[model samples]
Target: MKIQLLPSTFDENGTASRRQHLSCFVVDDRVAIDAGSLAMATTTAQKKQIRDVVLTHAHLDHIAGLPLFIDDLFAGLDAPVRVYCSAEVLETLERDIFNWEIYPRFSELKNKNGASVMQYQPFEAGREFTVKHLRIKSISVNHKVPTVGFIVSDAKTTIALTGDTAEMSDFWQTVNAETNLSALLIECAFPNELEELAENSHHLTPRNLQKELAKFNRKECAIYVVNIKPMYRDEVVKQIEELQIENLQILEVGQVYEW
Candidate 1:
C-alpha cells in the first residue's frame, strides 16, 4: 500500500497555516486515516473520492475539517463515505459534531443522488475485520476520552497508528503481537518539559514515548512520528533525538512512502 502524509509542518508549500497541530494521510489516495489538515492539502475533486476514513478519536485537531469535507463531497460521492471508529468516538462525532448545533447531521442528510454523506461503522476493540481490501483492527488506548488506535493492513503490509495515548500497555502489547507490520505512525503532543500536563491530559511527551516504545517488540518497522505540537516542535525533535531511537523519523506533509 502507498501512504502519503498531506501538508504538515515541514512540507507545506501553499498558504496553509504554519501553527500546525493537525494531520491527514492518504492511503492509496482513496482512504484517509484522519481529516485534521486536509482542508488545504487536497483538492475538492480528490476529497470527493474518499471512500474510507478511519478515525483515531474525535479530538478537534483530528476531526476539525470533517464536517466541511463531507459537506463538500456530498453531491459527488456515489455512496456514503464509511467512517470507522470505536463506539465512544462515534458518539462524539454524532453528538458533539454532527448534532445540528455544531453542523448539520450529514449522516441524516441525503444527497441529490440519495447517498448519505457519512456512515458510522462502529468497531469494537481487538476485533479483526475486513472492509473492502483492508484488514483493520482497533485497540483501546489510555486517553482522556474513550479512544482507540488502529492496525491497518492490506494483506501485504500492516500500518499502525497510535492516535493519542499516554503511557499505555494494551497498544504496545497489541503491536508486538502483529506478525507483519510495515510502519508505525504515532502522536507525540508535547516535549519532555511538559510531562506533567502530558500525563494528565493523556498525551505523550518524548520521555513517555521512549518508555512506552521500549515495551514493543516491533519487527524493525519504519516508525514515523506525527502530531508534535507546533510551538514545541523543535523541543520535541531535540528531546526525541536524545532518546536515541534508531528508526524514528518525523512525519512531514507531502512525504510519501510505499510499504
Candidate 2:
C-alpha cells in the first residue's frame, strides 16, 4: 500500500516548495482519506485519479476542500466523486457546507449526461466496505462532533488513522486486533500545557497520547502522529520527544510511504 499524507498547509510553489498544510491523505492515487487540503495539496494529475474520498468527520479542516475539488473536476468527471462517511457527517455536510448559502450543492449538480457530480455513500461506524483494492472500516472516536477513525488495508498490509480524538477505547481495541497492521497515524493536537484545552476540544496532548499508546498490544506497528496545530507545532514535537516513545514520530507533510 502506498500513502501520501498531503500537506495541510499551502505552498506558493505548489509541489515544488513541499510545504505542509491541513489533513488529507492520498491513498495509492485512487482514494483520499480526507479532503482538507485535497484541492491545494494535490497536483492536477493526481487529482484526476482520485475518484473516492473517505471523510473522518464533518469538521471544516477535514472537508474544506471537497466542494472546490468537485467543482474543479466538474467537466472532466466520467463518473461522480464518491464521498464515504457516516450518516451524521453526511447530514452535516448537506446542511452546513454544501447548502447553497455556503457552497453550491454539487450533489445536486450534474454533468453533460445529467448525472450528479458528487454522490455521498454513507457507512455505519464499525462496518467495513471495499473501495478498489482497499478494505476499509470506520471506528468511532471521541470528538466534539460526530467523528470516526479509519482502518484501511489491502488485506495483506493494514494501517489505521485516528482522526481528531481525545481519549478513546473502541478505536484502540479495534487496532489491537488487526494482525497485519503496519502503521498507525494518530493525532496529537496540542502541547501538555494545553491539557485543559485539549480535553475540552476532544484532542490529545502528549501526556494523553502516552496513555492512548499504552493500550496498543505491541510495539511492532509504526506510530506516526498528525494534526498538531501549526502555531504549537514545535512545542508539541518537543513534548513528544520528551516522552521518548519508541516507534513514534510526528508525521511529516508531503511524505510518502509504502508498506
- lDDT tens digits, residue span 38-123, model 1: 55566565575677888878888878877877776777777888888888888888899899999998888788888777898888
Compared with the true structure, what per-residue lDDT tens digits does model 2 show for residues 96-205? 98899999988888998676799989999999998888999999999999999999999579999999999999998999988888999999998999999999999999
True-structure lDDT of candidate 2: 0.89
Worst 10-residue lDDT window for candidate 1 reads 9-18
| TM-score of each prediction | 0.92, 0.95
- Cα error, residue 181 of model 1, in Å, equals 1.5
Local distance difference test, each candidate? 0.81, 0.89
- Ten residues in sequence with the least summed lDDT for candidate 2: 12-21
Off by over 4 Å in 1: 8-19
Top lDDT: which candidate number?
2
